[model samples]
Target: MKWLNKNRVLKVIFFALVVKPLVFIILGLNVRGKNNLPTKGPAIIAANHNSHLDTLVLMSLYPLSLLYKIRPVAAADYFLSNKYRAWFALNIIGIIPIERQRRVRKTELFSGCHTALDNDEILIIFPEGSRGQPEQISRIKKGLYHIVHDRKKTAIIPVLMHGLGKALPKGEALLVPFNCDVVIAPEMAEFQTADDFVKQLESCYQELKTYCITTTEQHN
Candidate 1:
């Protein structure tokens, strides 16, 4: 696992040469409010999960200088199931694996997240806990709530992604060329309760989705 973190050069090369071009040029990604992302980090990017493309699309919004600092939280059961996938997730994509099952200790989970934020890195967490239908945002799980509760100072950036599920839906191997849009909202720093925060986050996703649809129709 240590070697994986040391392979920063490989990660940059892969994202710059492969992921960026494939997502931006080949797939035709349309991103709005990218400047909403903070110049510095130690922040959390909470987004709705749909497809594998969501991670790549979100990471593309950041500049290369901050690329290495971006650490996505991925399901350990899936990404670390085998050596090949583990290497790809850890080294290539630079993901921080979290055990989705109940077997993982709570202390360990919080520790990993704390370490990342303490390092002033960006953490991309999908609060849905798993993938859902395209454009359909699910109820956020408690993991994000706990993270925020523990790390009070971290800024939360709400992001909504559209068209990723159609491009590469669940259980599909091949990716269809499609236009994907990512809408980033302004940062929220205060929350009264976990439930309230989650509710507001879901609302943000829906609002962004509507904005995407209206913008698309107007252009057409």
Candidate 2:
């Protein structure tokens, strides 16, 4: 897990010079309800997946101090396919890869996530499983629900991002400059079941979409 170790130098160089200016300055990121995030605690950030930029955009919103504690859960088959890709994913990005295709033991999947939370780190998970059409949220997966179920102390933060798919859509290498909005809702709790939690998660996405549309209309 040497690659997974928090490298302050790498994180500083990447986010300060690259991600921050690219996302917040050049691309023009609009964030709403950011105050809802706890200043410090173990959290599970559940958001819709669209573009590869989705993870970067989400992480950029966090304070620099907390950046080192953030870990994005990625697909093992895609991110760890080759040596170069694996190096970049584990070393540079500090992602926790999970086997999505082959049969993975439940213990294996939960172990990685549990360790992160146990260390008081933030875990970014896309419950949709994979990227879908831009701005279209897909069905929630059971992985997130299971993690939350086990780690009851960890807070669940529902996030909604718009325009990222268009900026760097699926299958496209180049990133087109586009304005994006990210809405961070209050931490959710009190769900009786995982299915109930999924419903609430979907609702958070829809509410954020509506807010984005309204804000856009007002600006126009």
Cα RMSD of all models vs. native, in order, equals 3.7, 3.7
- Summed backbone clashes in each candidate are 0, 0
Compose the digit string of candidate 2's lDDT tens values, residues 1-52.
Answer: 6544456668767888899899987678778888986556588888889899
TM-score for all predictions?
0.90, 0.90
Position 54, candidate 1: lDDT: 90
Clash pairs, model 2 backbone: none
Tell me the whole-model lDDT of each prediction, alpha carbons only: 0.81, 0.82
TM-score of 2: 0.90
Q: Alpha-carbon error at 84 in model 2, in Å?
A: 1.6
Model 1, global lDDT:
0.81
Which residue segments of model 2 deviate by more than 4 Å?
1-6, 213-220
